[model samples]
Target: MSLPTSTASPTPTRSTPRPATPSHRSGYRTGLRWLLQTHGFMFLWALGMLVVLVAAATIIVSNVTTPAGSIVQHARQGLTWFPFSIAIVGITTYTNIHIGAGLTRRSLGWAALTAAVVMAVAYAALFTLALQLERAVYGWTGWAHGVDGAGGLFTSSGQVGLVVLDVGLLFLAGQLSGVLVGIVYYRAGGWWGTLALPLTAGPILLATPALSTAALGDLGLAPRVVLVLLVLGAMSLAAHRLILGVQVRKLAT
Candidate 1:
């Protein structure tokens, strides 16, 4: 007998793609490596600056006139250091994502300049903020002192919080500058290896605050005012160094 004609029903199938496995996600190797290199540069460079400062302080305390060009020399050092630092920090991090992220020296020249501009902007912002904070504190405590001489930039602690913050900012800037210089040293010529970054940053960087202290003191400024200026100047120097650093690293293919 002929098989009874039976209609078969078809089952529907869902075709969604499978989710990515955990192994597919990118790891933190790049960030960790950059952090290691950057932070190492900062610590060693800062310690080196401190040692240099102590030596200079010792000489000055013995009645020797601190060198005439001491502070200016340090400030110049910042030009190379600041830009280079900004460049390396950015380039290094970007490189992990794109191995060939370097630009021509010409382009880097512009980038370096940009870094300097950024430093000024940052300083202005921070200084303004610090001043505002100082005003608020003064308003609440009713404590304000000192006169701002010509070019009030080198003036003092009408506000204690500002005084302390100013010092901290300078110290941090110096440390960051050192780190950038070191990184550039290594990038410019990897052969010097570990020592490259440190030595590159060793010059006037360590003596930044001391240089400022002597310079401001020579102007017959008060200790508190001089302290603030010294710290601020050091920070300015660090900023310049970082800008130069950014330029150097950005150019280093």
Candidate 2:
């Protein structure tokens, strides 16, 4: 009886390892699905922006009289409008996200983060388009645009002194958003209620620099005046953010 046992067959094996964890797979799909859906609104928004942007872009090329300087002027001038318009629309998007997130406690962070990420991407696209516009127009005639110039960190101008200005502006805008969000969260401990102040301040702050540097200061503000406006406005708003934050935390405690 001991010698009568039959040999067993080999077990089957899996050809592939299991895919990503179920949670990870679902999160990835959810993010992708969300981006696709939200991007429709962003696309529609871009159409309106295009009308303005294309006009600005073509203005330099349109003038047959000042062909040589038009492109250069356009590039230099467009920077001012670039940041201002973006800040305006961006804050709105941020507010929308904050509101949507507040729809539920569990989904709030994701909603807010999604808004920020989408807007950042939209901004980058616009920034790149603006640069390409300048480059195409400026480089059209030849290497020389009738002005001896150096390339700024991202511009045809020099990077030395202006890089600080560029970085400073971007950082300031970010700080404006963050501080506002923090203060709002601290004060009321809710999403929708916290967004309006920061969103409003960013545009106003953006206006100062945008007008100062925008296409030859067509806004009529002197560069120095614009700088003063920026510093003062930024400080006021930031202080407001802090005070409100303190009030929020005090109530919470």
The lDDT of each candidate is 0.38, 0.40
* Clash list (residue pairs), candidate 2: 77-215, 150-157, 151-156, 151-157, 152-157, 152-158, 187-248
What tens digits encode model 1's per-residue C-alpha lDDT throughout 88-127? 5653454323233332222222232233333433433434
**Stretches of candidate 1 above 4 Å error?**
1-88, 94-102, 144-153, 157-193, 203-207, 214-253
TM-score of candidate 2 to 2 decimals:
0.39
TM-score of each: 0.37, 0.39
**Model 1: which ten-residue window has the lowest total lDDT?**
2-11
lDDT of 1: 0.38
RMSD of candidate 1 to the true fold?
A: 19.5
Model 2: per-residue lDDT, tens digit, 54-111?
5665574556454443233333333433433443343333333433432222122332
Candidate 2 lDDT for residue 61: 51
